[model samples]
Target: MATSDLHMQLIAYDYVNDRKTDGGSLAKMASLIRQAREEAAETGALCILLDNGDTFQGTPVSDFLAKHPGTHPHPMVDALNALRYDAVGLGNHDLDYGLDYLGRCLAQFQAPVLCANLKTSALPMIMPHTIFQREVQTASGETISLRLGVVSAMPQLTASWNRHQLAGNADVEPAMPSLVRAVQEVRNQGADVVVALAHMGIATIDEGEDAQNEIVAIAGIPGIDAVVGGHTHLRFPGPDHNGVQGVDSETGLIGRVPTVMPGNSGSDLGVIDLRLHRPENALHPQVVSCTVQLRSVDGETPEDTEIAAVSEMAHDKTRAYLARPVAQLSNPMHSYFALARPSHVPALLAAAKRKAISEAIAGTELERLPLLAAVATPATGGFDGPENFVSLPAGELKRRHVAGLLPYANQVWAVKATGARLSGWLERSALLFNVLRPGDGDQMLVDPQVPGFRYDAIYGLTYEIDPTRAPRFDAAGKAISNEVGRVSDIRWQGKLVDPDQEFLVAVTNHRAGGGGVFRPFDDAEIVVKKAAPLDQALIDYLKNPDCHDIRTAAPWRFTPKLGVSAILHTAPEALEHLGDIPSLHPEPYGTTPEGFARLRLHL
Candidate 1:
């Protein structure tokens, strides 16, 4: 048997929420990491642990770190350091709490933070690329030295998506060229095998700079032996959650280069094994073949005792903070009808944001403009799973419940938009659905590629979505077709919305700052901007001891189409409410491949 010259194991994980429980707790992942290292040791293979960023924020625990910063190490940094991560990359969310805070928090990380595309002068801690020299025991019982190079890059859109946080501090340049340059630079440093830790998604279709979904293109770059991808919060070695064109849901390979994304919230760990081969007289080794796999921290796994013990104090504090009662839900709160119709969750959020905007613009010249609030549930089983839907019963609500409702700490902004621009916004949002053929069989209602969070539900305006008509705009908010128009009968205060009339649209800085492909939002005049997150306003509203029942009125629905029916993919738990929503006329229709149940809606 020919003895293998180099056996290397690479472990990559991303989107850890500093969760100490539920689906993904770094404490639970510690055991899996230890197990992988043990297996690699037994096989005499070198092991490297790399985090693909988005590690600092997600749950209330991480929220605590960002909201209340101190000299102490962030719980996430503590956990990662305890696990001894080799390196990590920066994700857009990592910059959510301002550049200074991000820098301070990352400074405590034992692992080197790398970001090649981020243009900055203040933070010297970030490296473009890094090289590691290691000694590996070959299968033939011979010890040989190996050189491994790792480079990291985040989406160029980080500049826009995190505009509130990165303003006047740093800018993220285009990722593709910058990443390619970093790869070449690392190779020039005498590195044998190269890896790209890409904090971007793998979308088959391109949507320009804001799309920033460049993992597929990154994988095709030469000298990049392997890739660890993030930002999309998707799971690899599984069916593509979104039907992104070029992605192979099963293998996660782009043109033969092996890549893996471990899914978000520390749910799973991405494992890539590379075999290095070199001629006996060669100066460096090259990758021969690579195998990729994802290990999920599912129900069967137990948390590492030592890690749990280390993080127990913080975990207890977070739980206590999250459990504080804020308000009472007179009835159950669910997002099953978030896109299909108005739900109380977003209805309450829009009401609070509308009030906040109203207060912010009370004396301004723009105060007279009619105000409308746009809200969307960030989670809809897209990446958070089927059970990710909100379903708090009639009882006291807590800080955690409110956090679950909105999730991200997105700031609220009131944008001055003309009715025409508002129409375009609604048209762009309608792209979330597929066109319903007049006489066709049951078809999927939503566009798999568009996330549920991107589907905006405008409050203070009533509209009907005509599925038989085609969408007027594409995902990038560009007008794609004239024959198909999904948005129709748009009305304000029981009257038609004038195309030229101006209005104040209550939106998040994420949308107003051009986080999505929504147009006009980038250039729209900002009449009101809140320094605090939208969730804060909600928490205050809920905390009011005199808070009443959350009022949810159905102001929008699908236009009646006699012969067409649609399939709504939702949490299986929503089946119990089939008879409650009269507008949708929903009926259970078995389960989808993603474990979500399908509901047949009679239009």
Candidate 2:
């Protein structure tokens, strides 16, 4: 029988120890790597470790590194070097610190970093593709030579933030073509297996889907064996949407073509093993089997000592830096996740945006306009998670913490839409919830099953969603409902809104561009000019005292039929502000005293 050779053990997406507790995942990952390495050695197999991306910024450590640069070197890079990652891809979050910081972080890593889509003529070290060739001795003692080619592609949305640094030098335009060409070039150089390490997410037919996401779009191009993807942070055991299956290493389930994504923040390790069989022509070897394995970073094993030590050092350094009080706030600031409840953080943010938009347009042809402002809770905004919680010890609130609370640098934009258009936008937001049927369901106020997208809106006008009622509008802005849910108690000039009256509305650029799938405002008439450094408006608004009133209730209210049981779910912090509302509920079914009395009082 021909001697069988195993080319195996590929580890993917170990985001190790972010800014949180000294890299919770990093310490675990180090131990996992050590174990994997030992296992690979015992099995006479080669181990290649690849990190997909988002290593640079997530926790407080990343925050400190970005703000107070000289105090601490890039700790994430240091941890990755300790883990001895073979190659790393540049994710969009890595660029959050700006290009110069990204370069510094890259320099700190010993491993070769590849970002095929992100280019800089000035920096030759930032190569688009890397080719690694290894000569391995089989169990039968025959040496087999193999070449692996890796090319990386990041999402195009990063263009907005990376423009300054990546401009003129970084070419995101021809990314897929460049990736294809890079794979071809590597094949020409005799690479046996070509892998496209993509930093983009799984493609969807929705608005955010990038053209490069279609695996078939790049598949069938010459010499591509496997594609490693990231950015979306989804775990695909099989080749998702592309017939790829992750090789099961433990079960020896071979021949699976799975595109693997180890869950974000070093939660899991993706392992792919390839078995090589040499044919008559040594150059053209056959890939007999492919296997995938996933090792949890949170396993009970002891942490990797070296990585643990480095994470500890980073933790101590970050704690000390953030420990120094930065600023003091007269009122306590809190963050709560539940959307039904009122939160000081989102309320503060919304109030700030409202004031800024109001000031920006106060006397400029859009004065005294009723505007709705909204801000998303960055951490809990993802539709999952227990109530959003922000712990504020009674004292000075650091600017760093505040910045951490609102991390995304999204700008504020004002657009003018009609009452119908605005109602459609809220309806889209309501779609974030699961459609609940009346009489068969629990309280409507705190339906946890209701998706976060629906509860996320902080409105200038009060509104209620009738779960039983189908949407009145289609994805396009056309009326589909006759008399479903009402946007009642909407007082403009001390009275209900007239459908014919035009209202000036304000929202973030993310919202304006239909980020939350609210497409109605995309066609809204834009009034105020776009503000540069939009987050600056937020910062300025926060510093001003006149803008801090968050006690005002939303003008409208939902009056479901008697005994219909309306429930609202919001973060714990929101309870402080929303506690008095008759309609407010904690979550699921917990309702306030006011809610009970309101039903009785109104009935």
Candidate 3:
């Protein structure tokens, strides 16, 4: 019994967008971390807490920090510091404000922020990898030193998403090469095990240069013992999501690699346990066995009182900030029929962007081009659950309401686009809808593969979405439909859209920079490449005295599908406003497995 068995525990989570529910509270995670450490101690195993990044910039509190930067430490970093997180990888959103701000915010963290692929002049804040040396007690009551080599990296799209912010400040390398080299270096540094803290998603699809969702491929790289994933905000150990191959959603195993992806927003904790053995003939510490587990904060784990106390001030201020009145709505805002048409929320956003852009270029050369605002439904109940839908009563639009609606802190941007390119953009967005065959009975409206945020609805244009037709573009914006058009009868400013006509479309920086597979946007001529956050722009638009009782123009509609009706599962609250959208012919069909109320839309 001279050589004892070592139990290595790795826990991670991603896309914890912001602290709205108890499910994703860092305080709750703190309690879970403590419980995990206690359990590991009882079993004579080792426990190390690692974060998969996307820590800051999800909530109004984080947004406030970005808007008003100062010497005060970020609330998220404060919580992470108090929790004593061993290390954290960089998430793409971590650089939303800028590289310098990210560095400053990360400075307060007690744990090292690991990101190997990001090559930056600021080396003190970020590095390729790090070796954590710890002592763990064995079952035989013997303590031994263990070296955990951790290499963290993110998708190359960080360069694209944060292009304006990272243009010259930093650059990102291909994750695989950077990861491989780091693994070798850490191994050479007398590391017993190598773990990859990847801020990427588990994707079977080719990731191209971005490598944003390449966790499955990363597991196959040599010298890696385990992986903790993030970015896609998915929960593994559940089911093969979005057609990702080689992943056992039931076991959280991808190609024999033990992995964990705790659902985003502090909702769950991803735990990977590795049983290490030092065989007499073995050259290194071999992981003879591995197990993955997901721990959710579903009224089971209590919130850490201390951690909660530390963030209470931020929480209170954000709550008050969100409650402040900004404007008034003529009608209620909801996303139940956002996919079927340009619903109220998206319509309002587009109107705001249109107004903002029009004002900015009133006398400029760009004013001559037809103006359109491209906006997606933000409050769609996708990752945020059925209750995630935006349902603001016809009253004052509070800051909190905007936070709930806009969600992300994406800045407003305007791009010059040709009619053909705009058609392709809409076609790409149309991919979100499942092809509706004529006379087909109630079918799911949305394609689970396409996220709600990518479903762009261009304002200032009237078009019909023909469900029977194939999308002119795929989810990646490739012209795969081959003349079989999904978007048809497009009219700009009451005239048929000319394919060669030039126009300026308002979009978020996230969209303009190719955050989604919506291509051509990135190549489009930049007009207003930088502006205040979209939500802020909307706020400004609303607060202006000229705007009173705003209403959606309802410029888009679905081509009549006689017997083919689409059903969208949304929050039960949608039932109250079934009368508002007469076009959907909304009827409560039933409830989804996740308890979302299914409303059938007669297209």
Task: Indicate which candidate wins on TM-score.
Answer: 3
Best first by TM-score, ranked = 3, 1, 2
TM-score of each: 0.91, 0.75, 0.92
In the predicted model 3, the residue pairs found to clash are: 16-265, 24-266, 322-400
Model 3, TM vs. native: 0.92
Per candidate, the number of residue pairs that clash is 1, 39, 3
* Local accuracy of candidate 1 as per-residue lDDT tens digits, 1-603: 000000000111111222333466565567778989999988999999988877766666667667777777666677677878888788888777778888887788887889999988777899999998989987788998888889999888778778767778888888888988999998898998888998876775557556777877898898998888867766765775346655666666777787887776656778989888887898778777778888877656777776666555555666677777788776777887676766777778877887778777777787778988888765576655686687767897777777677667789888888888878888888888888776565788787777888888888899998867778876666677545577889999899999999898888988887666676355438767773478887876665522342464555777765567788889888888876677667878889776898888877
* Segments in model 1 whose C-alpha atoms lie over 4 Å from true places: 1-22, 241-252, 438-441, 543-552, 592-595
Error of 2 at 149 (Å): 0.5
lDDT of each: 0.74, 0.55, 0.75
lDDT of 3 by residue, 1-603 (tens): 000000001111111222344345667777777888788878988887888777776766777667778776766777777877787788787777787777788778788878999988864778789899999876577888999888999888788888888887789888888999999999999899888988887764554444468888899998899888877877777763645678888777888788887777666777888888888886677888888888877656677888777776666666566667889876566777677666767777887887778877877898888888888887677765786677777777677777777767677889999888888888878888898876666778887667888788888888988876777765545566346777789997678999999989898888888877766355448778665667768888876533332363666777764457877878888788777778667888888887798887877
Error of 1 at 252 (Å): 4.2
Worst 10 residues of 3 by lDDT: 1-10
lDDT of 3: 0.75
The TM-score of predicted model 2 comes to 0.75
